[model samples]
Target: MTHGRQGGDGASDPESAGGGASDPEDPDAPTPSDAFGALGGETRLAVVRALDTESPRAFSDLAEATDADTTAGFAYHLRRLTERFVRQREDERYELTDAGRSVARAVAAGTYTASVDRDPVELDEPCPLCDGDGLVAAVADNVTEVGCGDCGGTVLRLSLPPGGYAARDSDEFADAVDAHHRRRIESFDDGVCPECTATVSARIEPAEDEADHGASHRDDEYVPVQTVYECETCGADLRCPVALTLLDHPAVVAFYHDHDRDVRDRPIWNVGSEWRERAVSRDPWCIVVSVRLDGEVLVCYVAGDGRVVDHRRESREEPSARADADDSATGTHTDDSTAVSTDDAETVRANDTAESGPAES
Candidate 1:
């Protein structure tokens, strides 16, 4: 788990080279080997779980909590965790640092210690593409998937830490998952990786129209293009219909609110006709997505970069459907869920994912 490094060249402090990561010679700078090495053994790990709070814990208490090879050996391990994961106060009491707290909670979240899945929970919503039945939500390998079994196509897929499902009650389970998952999507839309807070790059490309793929049953009914955001470091992948990037946009949210519907209450697949995108171009990328409510429409001009640059509203009976209008400057911007982006579309998939809490299930 790489962290925001806090080292500076303490040119005078024997341990520092005066510049942090910039100075490869800075011995005190945060490094993968050193950060992870601090928790390499059971003793060190136990120490992290023991001092899980900001309140200082005396050395004796930490040692007693994690009785190790020996008191001296335990003390040595504690020393190793000192700056990167632990902090020592003036009175010599110790506490977990910000990164340390994150580690503790993540462990509790079951990212490092658990694998989970659940039986399919039948959903009342129909498949957006095929209008098929048997649409259900299931978890496997820690990823939550919602799709139609009959067509064998996945409509939506996202990673969920073990706690994502295991911690919710049946009555509120689905809504909780929706809120959590949507937040992750919003994060990606903002050009930020929810997992590691890294800069996320974005682009637009043709969506997979494979008939055999999940939900591609409609010969011409498919998300024609998608916006993808990828973490530069941790490999978190988030892909969605270009319109989905506006899921939280003020205008979009207000549009749904005015219609007596809470858009956030349902998954993107369930939103059906309310949210949609059809590409306007591929080069430099542009997309026109319409949110239709009560025979009225709101057209958003999205650039390849995923930002909603312009918008207009019209009655469904209006003369021309803007779907055919070309908006050429759509900004350009992942396989977290399988929208099936292609080779020429600039797909970015990360083999390694960051810590698991709040990630796609």
Candidate 2:
């Protein structure tokens, strides 16, 4: 998974995956433009396509697969792809390098050449915003959308890669989109960029205002606070509501566990009313995300930098039943929202979940 992002800076003798020490400013090394320029022709593409991608192939076998009129022509195209995209093995068989495999994967995924649109298909999940039962999933231009049919509010929006959507029906497409966002989000939560594995910086800010990362999701359809993550190295970024950051937090997971529900199984748009996030402070940026089930409430105090400063749970002596089969919650917080502090009151389970979920687009 290593790339050229390294080897250009730091260290007296940075090591190359090659047995020799890396040369930071090797004059003959291929430039980024040169690496891409080699793949511009049909002949070069034939060589890449012939690779199927990984098993090493003899030079004669590769030359036989391409439509090159002569072996010299095939050899010329192979030479252009060598070093950066294709590499020759010690056994004299040809294989793709990491960058070459990346191109093959992109080609197979249809990322650069595919477009898709699927009519709205009604989803069984309810809208978290309006609590409306008429929720639907739709795909257009390679992006999947889940919105409320009643309120016309968006529940989830994610740009899915073509391979994740093209062969799937609406239900499978929705599941694919949810799973994709969940992985990227989990990567972001771990303080790493999903694209390049760079250390990402994070902060919480007003949804309607742009943060330092040039992030602005300021439409009336969004929440009050939005969380932003940016990779200073790769300049990649991700945005979602502040509540999204707590989907895997220990207290929140335990609260859902106690109610006999798996929070991770719930769709990104059907997270229940307890997820209405708000920031009680902005100068120091402290966020309040509470998950309420029956008369039991779980409160998480989060800092602006996406850290959970503190958390506590308040429950009735005997809380009500778990959320119903229709995916709706029961029992609002009683007048005594702070009903417990003595022994049975602020009891939070110490369990933490490894899986995370998407709460926003």
Candidate 3:
């Protein structure tokens, strides 16, 4: 009569028997029941199977798919599954919670790979704070009010997922991270005035004057060491140092921390070599830009504890601004004028209105 144990009849009620408690092969190990009592019933199993497939399904969809005896019946099972952390709902949609999905996928995959097996950076479970499904599609346009089917919760603003692409460990990985960081730093330079752009040049340089490091003066005085590039086009006379904004991205942090031995205690300390290699191994193309064109070019590094600073202006023309402009103009707009004739015109009108507020009446 226990919730999970079966009677001697050999054909016990599926509801009473523990469903996902443990591997049938290993009764003594930690079972799904120990984590949550979700794997405990037939109806709940059906509910989970339904969610595992196309998710963000409505309650009606679940009823239709599962052929539940009643909506109340479906709700009963869903509630129980929820109590066991098997599923979640967002607004009207129902989907597996992260824990639910993780388990569901494990069961589905037949052989679940342990977290240790993969690059430590590859895992991003549900939002620990809010257990919404971690998967989200990136939209070039603005997104609003996304719902998590598992938790039935609504997120008012949708954020782009952390750049999750990973770099494999190889000769090329270091080059890729360095290249990505360079592109991000160059992007910051492109946004500034020509003068600062020339000076910033999107590169980090050690202060030429040792006096700038405060070594000439008392050691107690803090002298700025890292230099960021600034955009001269923005009329900023002073350029700022490139900040490591990628650290804010959890995936990027994992790349460094997970591959700790490779980056730390290096024989020859080359940020370009060791850090870049480590960065790419976590997730390729994970750079985040956090530079602004203040009076002085201001850039914040985001790879670790985020920080801000100013850089010296070196010149007026940024090294790569022209190439970026050419790429923007030609790369994505091959047939711009022809393509904008019909639907694009309407979009242009809407955009103009959004930007200018009807020409100020």
Candidate 4:
């Protein structure tokens, strides 16, 4: 169970890098080994789970939150988790950074998905490998384990869709699939802006689509329309311009290419996490699009192996429960001891996630 590294440098206590403990640190200094090493253990991840779900807590509190005896063993894992982006200490108390939150959320989500599929796989269910969609056999006969470019799950064999053929030897194809899997987070199709209750659409065209005929020269002024997550109650639109910069992220573009290659000819249109994110990136949309007419919120996610996963309705009870529990145990209410600057916290968060927002589940 190796967690992938997509973000910036590994987690390190800024204070111990020959720099003062309180000094703000740069995010690019840590190495991949440093980052992965920090998060490679079960105990470290457990420590992370303890901090992320709970509010900021003192060392003793963290041990309690995890229901682990406050032994030397628990202390060691806590120290290691702090070194990783999974947990950060403030005034000697711990909490989850944004990046840590993302990773924990994904890991927890992946765990659930795995559990859901466990019985089928154990029972030798029909192609439970690809959730029964079937896979295109990989060209390499000896490659026993392959990650699904569509869902991110490991499969015993590559299953191709009907009428689609993969050129196994093509490096380009492999690269394309790798890229897709890397950026595989699920997206919202009906996000209603928190402000505007209306359904947000990512269908805005490039600004250059209707250029001025009289203009002598056209700059690259073709800005993609900004996507807005509408707030149904007040009609305020919230949007992130970066969300529209789809191809800007190499991983995302690669996702488009992979699915297009494997399922291009089929009448069935494949919709996965990558595809959903691409839509979110291109359209002015939300992750949980609101269907005001039905008073429903749409949610989506990516599976471990690259499949687009989805959940529905207004509440994420499971995630909310997990987050709430973590927060309750570790969350500290004090501003002085528990407070963390947004910049420092975000840096910690980004280090763990910079690599895979394109495919975040």
Candidate 2 structure quality by residue, lDDT tens digits, 30-92: 765677788988877777777865368998888877788998888888998996899999999
Candidate 2 local distance difference test against the native: 0.66
- Name the runs in model 2 displaced over 4 angstroms: 1-29, 210-223, 316-361
Alpha carbon deviation, residue 188, candidate 4 (Å): 15
Give per-model TM-scores: 0.75, 0.75, 0.23, 0.28
lDDT of 1: 0.64
Candidate 4 wrong stretches, greater than 4 Å: 1-28, 67-70, 86-91, 111-361
In candidate 1, what are the lDDT values of residues 1-361, reduced to their tens digit?
Answer: 0111123552233222222232256755777656776778888888888887435799888888885868888878888899689989899999988989988988778888788767788888888767888788887877767888778778877666778777775444566667776788788777787887878787775667546466433322334677777666555666676766777887777888888887676666676756656653444454667777887777666666666655666776551322222112222221111111232122211111113221120
- Candidate models: Cα lDDT each: 0.64, 0.66, 0.36, 0.37
Query: Would you give me the overall lDDT of model 4?
Result: 0.37
TM-score of candidate 2 relative to the true fold = 0.75
Candidate 1 global Cα RMSD: 11.7
Candidate structures ordered by lDDT, highest first? 2, 1, 4, 3
- What are the per-model numbers of colliding residue pairs? 23, 0, 49, 60
- Point out the higher-scoring one by TM-score: 1 or 4: 1
Best by lDDT: 2
lDDT of 4 by residue, 271-342 (tens): 222222212222212221111112222333222212222323333344345445545665632111112233
The TM-score, computed over Cα atoms with residue i paired to residue i, of candidate 1 is: 0.75
